[model samples]
Target: MNNQDIKAKETTKDSKYIQQHLANERTFLAWIRTAISIIGVGFLVTNLHFTMRSTLSPLGNQLATLIGLVSVAVGIVTIILSAAVYVKKIKDINNQTFRPPVISMIFLGVFIIIISLIFGAYFFII
Candidate 1:
């Protein structure tokens, strides 16, 4: 094939794979949004301890700070891991070996549940 013909063929191949690439981009953006939200919540929780210290017991403030730090840490970890996963998914798509994303979803669900329990305890028990 001539150079122009080879370039046209490659473009066609890429066009056929565009949908998967777009889906990967969307997933990456969603993960970014999730990470930002988690970090924001962490900041809110952390500040609440200081703002409402008079009403909260000392132990309550401590618990809030701890939870906030953990949340922030998890958010950072999520961003790092998501970036890695995004890269892996793109590579897999290019190689036609993409796998279902089950483990990350399960981990996210459990993380949300645990965070919910922490917030419930903070509001009701502490």
Candidate 2:
């Protein structure tokens, strides 16, 4: 066979959707990074509260603790959901039936808003 013919055969052996798969993987990694950041902030906030406990009122300390715990829970949930999303996307890509996950996007948006409001209230209280 000619060089072009051999290369075409090799290309066919690889997935035609390689680019889409790569993009999906990148998106998964981004989600993981976001989860880690959320977890890190949770830990940081909790530690900061402990560090400054002497100056904090009882209610302020409790609120900080609650916020930190909630942050960690949200991060954990994000990790799980992102993994699920990654799996679903892989299936969708392979089937050539990809569609944006609108519900997940809406849930994430609402979650962020709620978290921001909680943070804002906590800061306002302190």
Candidate 3:
């Protein structure tokens, strides 16, 4: 095969590898939107804390505060890591070495656990 043919094959449009890279980019953008929503939730919760404090029991009030703080913290943390992952993933794709270290997934698991805990606390207390 000619060099042109090899070059074309290396980065073919129909290649699964190319499709996966595109998919990753789309997923990264989706994650960014999710992070923004999370930050918004954090902001709302923290601000709403003042308005709801009078209606909530003592434990409920505290739980709300904890959830607010944790939500913001987790949102910030995930935002940083997600950006890093997205950049690294792009680099990996360019180098044809698209493997993740799995740290982000682990972090995601932890974030889910935190959210679950927050809800569980609210339910148990109320």
The lDDT per prediction is 0.84, 0.85, 0.75
TM-score, every prediction: 0.85, 0.85, 0.68
TM-score of 2: 0.85
- Stretches of model 1 off by over 4 angstroms after superposition: 1-9, 12-15
Superposition TM-score, candidate 3 onto the true structure: 0.68
User: Looking at candidate 3, what is the lDDT of residue 32?
Assistant: 81
Q: For each candidate, C-alpha RMSD in Å?
A: 2.4, 3.4, 5.0
Q: What are the per-residue Cα lDDT tens digits for candidate 3 across 57-103? A: 78777777787787777778777877888778776776777776698
List the candidates ranked by lDDT, beginning with the highest: 2, 1, 3
Order by TM-score, highest first? 2, 1, 3
Q: What is candidate 2's lDDT per residue for 27-88, written digit by digit as tens?
A: 99998999999989888877887798567987778888998888888889889988998889
Model 3: residues with Cα > 4 Å off, grouped in runs: 1-21, 44-50, 100-103
Off by more than 4 A, model 2: 1-14
- lDDT for model 3: 0.75
Q: Which whole-number lDDT from 0 to 100 does residue 108 have in model 3? A: 73
